[model samples]
Structures are given as structure tokens and as C-alpha cells.
Target chain A: MQDPQSQIVVIIIAITIVLLFIGILFLVMIWSYNNKKLQMAREKQQIQDAFEKQLLQSRLEIQEATLNAVSQEIHDNVGQLLSYAKVQLNIMEQQATWGQEELHAIKDTIGTAFTALRNIARSLNILKHAAATRVQIDMLYLPEQLQINIHDNGKGFNVATALTNKEGLGLQNILNRARLMGGAATIISQPEEGTSIKINVPYA
Target chain B: MHIHLYQYTQFLSLLVAILCYEGLCKYKLSAFLPMLVIVNLIEVTGANYRALGYIPWLSNHAIYNLNLLLETPFRLYLMGQMLRMRSNERLTFRGIAFLCMLVILLNYLFLQGPFVFNTFSLILIQILTIVLSCFILLRLALREDIRPNLWQDPYFWVNAGLLLFALITLVILGLQQYMQDHKVMLGGKSLYKAIMPLPNFILYLGYSYAFILCRIPKARSLLSS
Candidate 1:
């Protein structure tokens, strides 16, 4: 039979080895547990980012679609009307018996054409600015709010008309996106002044 | 076992589990209460037999071996169900349970006979359970759609508690051979039995907490966003 001391040493060594193995296993578990937590957090963040990006893309698409429709309406309807009015004024001017009042009316008609053209140019500017608008994003860590402000140097509109106009589908889209993201959106603008749209979304 | 400290712990755990039966029922974990009651019954039966006389064939050790055989597949089934829910994948619970039953039967018939303590089967179950628990935890962590708050989820608590208990038990099981050979030199058989109940305590206490704390989700809705 083996000595009791020698047997105790063997058992101690065996137990120690098993303990070491378990220690290694425990460490591995802790590492994996922390690793899983980090991975979950990363995945959640990616999902949030993807969702937000999709919202922004859809908003842009709607805005671009609305702008295209507006430009088409202006060219096909308002532009055609102005061109016809100009042509009629020119034809009246060429008549044999044109009076002073008729000449004044002709000049007034020309003035209206100029004004219409200028307004058309301003509308075109609004479209261009909308296309080129820069969106600045700032996340407030304290309040956990994401603020997105779109800035444009273009002819602005009356606040009431922009808010209530069915034609301002772009603004409506922005507001919808803000609401979807659990936030609010507002447009700040004055006639002939630049427009700035601010959207606030809850980061949480 | 007439262990004073453990008896109190067991009593507390059983009381809590019984009281929170409604919460467990909501989670479709109503089976847990009856299972625990059966466990307590088995414990009492084994103790009664041991007190009657040290009949090796009808001892607590034999009963433990029998319990291991019955509990392995049932535990696996519950874990598998939880895994399927969290993974959103169709897991073959029946197939896995069948395999476990086969393995335990084979081990009992060949390696560790019916009358003897079945360390091999217990070790095998521990290893498989640990691996499955790890896989579940990894899947939960790597999931993209919604990351659940682990503290709030009953399954998370249950799995975590089981994992902790299994890990410690695995270590003890691994050293079983050494302990068996030097039983007298180390401090005799009671050392092993004394150590085994601790992990059980942790597991039962954890289950009780889960019963109390968790607002279990609906069927197949495991993850909480």
C-alpha cells in the first residue's frame, strides 16, 4: 500500500489541476459574458443607425419628388400663362389704332411678365437650395436628443403658407420623420430670407 | 440529508417557489413547481431510506443516480425550449431528449451499472448542459433585432443560475476520480456530498428569484426589447 502522505500529495495535485481547469473555464465564461454584452450593444446601435438612415433617405426622396412636381407645374402652367400674356400684349401693341392707355397697359403687361419671371427664378432657387441643403446633426448627451438642422440659402416663404400649404410636402415629410423618431420638427423662414429646418429626436 | 444550513435554504427556496406559482405559470414554467416538489419528495424518500439502515442498494446515492437519469432530459427540454424561443429557430427538442435518454441508458447499462453511483452520466449531462447554456448566452448576445435586459427576463436568470451551478458542479465532478481513490485520506465520502448541495442551493434560490422578479413574456416571445 502507498504511504498516506504520498496518497494525500497525489490527491492534492489532482484536485489542484481540476481547480486550475475550472478557473480557466470561469475566466473564459466571464470574458464571453462581457463580450456578448458588448456585441448586443453594438448590434442595437447598428439597428438604430440603419433605421434612422432609412428615415432620412425616405424623407429626401419625398422632398425630391415634391420639388420635381412643383418645378414641372411651374413650367407647364404658370410659365405658359405668362408667355401667352406677353404674346397677346405684343400683338395689341402692333395694332393700327393703339391709344396711350393701351400703351400703358402694354407696359404694365411687360412689368407683370418681368415680375413673373423673377418669381419663377426665385422658385427655381428654392428648388436648387432644397437639393443642396446641408443637414447638421448634433446629439445632446445630457438630454439624449438628436437635433438635425437643415440649412439653405434660398428664397423663403411666409410661415403660415409653408405650414398650411399642401404644396409644401417636403416640410410635411420632415415633420412626419421627426414624429416617427419620437421627436418634433419646425421650419423657420421669412419671405426673401433663407430657410432653416430643425428636427429633434429622442436618442433613447 | 439533515444539513441544518442547507435545510433552511431549501425551505426558503421552496416557500418562495410555491408562493410565486402564478408568475411561473404565466411564463409557462408552471412545471417548475411540481418538479421541485418531486425533488423535495425524492430528498425526503432518500433520507428516510438512509435512516432505516445503510442498505447500499437502496441508499441516497442510488436514488441520486436515478434522479440524474430522469432529470437530464427534462432539464434539456426546458433549456432547448428557451433556446428555440431566443434563437427564433426550430430546435429538435424531442430528438435531443431522445439522444440524452439513449446516452444515459447506455452509460447506466455498461459503464456505471444500475446499483452503482453514475458519475459518468452526471459528468456527461453537466458538460452538455454547460455547452447548451453557453450557446444560448452567445446567441442572446449576438442577436441583432432587440437586446433584452437580462435582469428582467426569467429565462436569463434561470439560465445564468444554472450555468453558475453547472460550472461549479463540473469542477467537482472532474475531481471525482481523485476524490474517490483517496476518500479516507481526503476526509471520506461526506466531503463530496457536502459540497454537492451548495450549487443546488444557488440554482434553487435563483429559480425562486426568477419566479418573483420576472414578468415572463408570452409563448415564443422570449426576448425583451
Candidate 2:
């Protein structure tokens, strides 16, 4: 007769082995799944960046066209009028009907007005997608967190409006980029003060 | 004649494995290396006792009890570290003392009958190890952060080796159970009674794989970061 005892022991051990195999297979599946998700997120970000570049080019083209139109109006219309006014003042200065001091003061005021117009015309370079408008983006690597700040010396806005509500295209685009990076943007600025946007993204 | 040669030659191989492990302790793989090699030694001792039980001239002898002398605490510590370690290189000698207490308790409870101690101890070791190993694998599976299985990493050879051992154990036990039900051993030749050591042989293969796997660098990397 066979020993019924050892057989019982054999059965118990066999069951344990099968359970172990199942456990190991389950662990491998979860690890592979997480890796797949990380790779997909990286690829999606690349596509978004390419689309943003194309859209930025189109917007800049339209903006330069508007600036160019304004520049032409100031030069062709107001510029000729100012030259005629300057000649009339020269005659006024020679006749001594108005003091030389008064004539020079009016000329100085007109000169300041022309300088303001020229400043607006200079910005057309950026609007026309000139090489000078290229923005330098730097990403700082830190433990567990990523900080990206875009630096540009231009007119800024109230922090409350940018954070609470989407207003201008510039602020809206900054917010969009922050969201893409899995973070929030902090805009620190005043009316005359320049703009600085800070974004922090966490490692996945 | 072939059987005699196999028995004698196998004994030499087992002895060499044990001595080589002792000599190479500087390699530090010996942290749990002795436990594996000693299991075969225990089997040899137990087989001798079982033979004595069948032959009235010999009785429970002193020489074989030497296996028990160093075996209980050594095997327990060896196995305890296998499941419980943070790393292969980090073994606490202090934990070994505690494991001996648990093993002694198991022996006191389980060693009641006339059945061979080796047979029961072998089965017991396999059951406990399988449970502990499965639990470790379960933790690895449930975690979201561990690296994917490094199949190419040599260090993971321990993992792959453990699975291989479990598989072989599964097959051997399943066959033994089948053979028991069929009463295949009833009329077997006395000399050939249980000479087949396929199950234990595979168990030894598993240990050898584990020992050699500790030498693999990639296995450590997979678990570390």
C-alpha cells in the first residue's frame, strides 16, 4: 500500500508554487503599464510644441501688418503736416512776432511726439517675426520639480487678472504652456513694470 | 554498478559544493550559501536513518545527529534572510538567533511520528519558502514605482532562478502525488526504492542559481533604484 501521508504534503507544496507564479506575473504587468503612460505623455508634448510654433508665426504676421499700417499713416499723413508747421515757425522766428524762446519750445514738443511714434515703429520688427524677437527659453532642473521662466522686457499686467481670468493673448498663451507642463504659472508684474512668468512642473 | 558509481560520485559533488562555498566566503555569496549546500547533506543523513529503520542492526545513531547539530539554526537563518532582506549584501547575524527559536518550535511540534525527519523537513522548507517568495513577488507587482522586470540583468537571475525552482518543485510534487495514488512504489526493488532525487536535485539547481545570481550586477540595480 502507498503511503498516503507524503502525498498530502506534495499537494500542498504544488499549490503554493502555482500561486507564486501568478503573483510574479501580476507585478510585471503593472510596472510595464506605468512605463507606457510616461512615454505617451512625452510624445504628446512634442506634437503640441510644433503646433504652437506654427500658430505663433501666423499671429506675428498679422500683428506686423497692423503695426506697418499705423507706421505708414504717421509718416505719410502727420509727417508732412509737421514739416509744413516747422517752416511756418521758421518765418515766425525771423519776424520776431513770437519770441525765439516760444518757437523753440513748440519745436521741442513736436520733436518729443515724433520720438514716441518712432518707438512704435521699432516694435514692428518683433511683430514682423524679425530675428531680433527670438526668445531664449531656459529650463532649470531640480529634484522632484522643474521651473521654467520666460524673460521679456515688455508691458505687463496685474497679477490678479492673469491668475483669475484669461485676458490678453500673451497671458493666455503663458497659462496654456504651464498647463501643458503639468503646472501653474505665476505672473509678477505692475502697469509700467515688465513681466516675469514662473512655471513649476513635477516629475512624473 | 552504475547506481553505486552515481551514489558515490554524487556524494563527492555535494561535498565539493559545500567546501567551495566555505572557501569562497570572501566572495560574500556565502551569506546564505551554506543553507543550500547543507540541505543535501541533511537529505543524505536522513536517508541513512531511514535505511537504519528498515534494518534492525542499526538504530538512531550519533554521527547522523550531527546534521541536526548545526542544521536547525543555520537553515532557518538562511531562509529567513531570503524573504526578509533589503539587499543580499546586508545580512544581520543577530536575526539568525531569533530564527533558530522559531525553527526549534516547528521541530518540537512536527517531529512526533516515526516518519523520516528529512522527508517532512524537505516538504516544510519548500512550503514556507514558496509562501514567502510569492508574497515578495506580490509586493513587487502591486507597486507602481519599481523598475520593469530586468530579464537581461544577470542579478535578476535570482528571481528567474527562484521561479524555475518553484516550477520544478511543482512538477515533481505533482508526479509524486500521482505515483502515490497509483501505488507505484508497492512492488519496487528495495535498492531502487527512492534513489531518484529529481525533486531535490531541482531544488539544488534552484539554490545554485540563487547563489550564482547574487554575483549578477543587474539584479541589484533593478531592486535598488
Best by TM-score: 1
Give the best candidate by lDDT. 1
Judge the docking of candidate 2 as incorrect, acceptable, medium or high: incorrect
Cα lDDT for residue B164, candidate 2: 46
lDDT of 2 by residue, A121-190 (tens): 6655323222233344578998988988765555545767655664356566566656666778876777
lDDT of each: 0.67, 0.51
Q: Among all windows of ten consecutive residues in candidate 2 chain A, which has the lowest summed lDDT?
A: A125-134
lDDT of 1 by residue, B177-200 (tens): 556666633344444565666777
TM-score of each: 0.56, 0.40
Candidate 1: RMSD to truth: 10.8
Which portions of model 1 miss their true places by more than 4 Å? A1-204, B1-4, B7-11, B18-30, B51-58, B85-93, B106-113, B146-156, B171-182, B185-189, B216-225
Q: What is the lDDT of residue B45 in candidate 1?
A: 65
**Candidate 1 displacement at residue B129 in angstroms:** 1.8
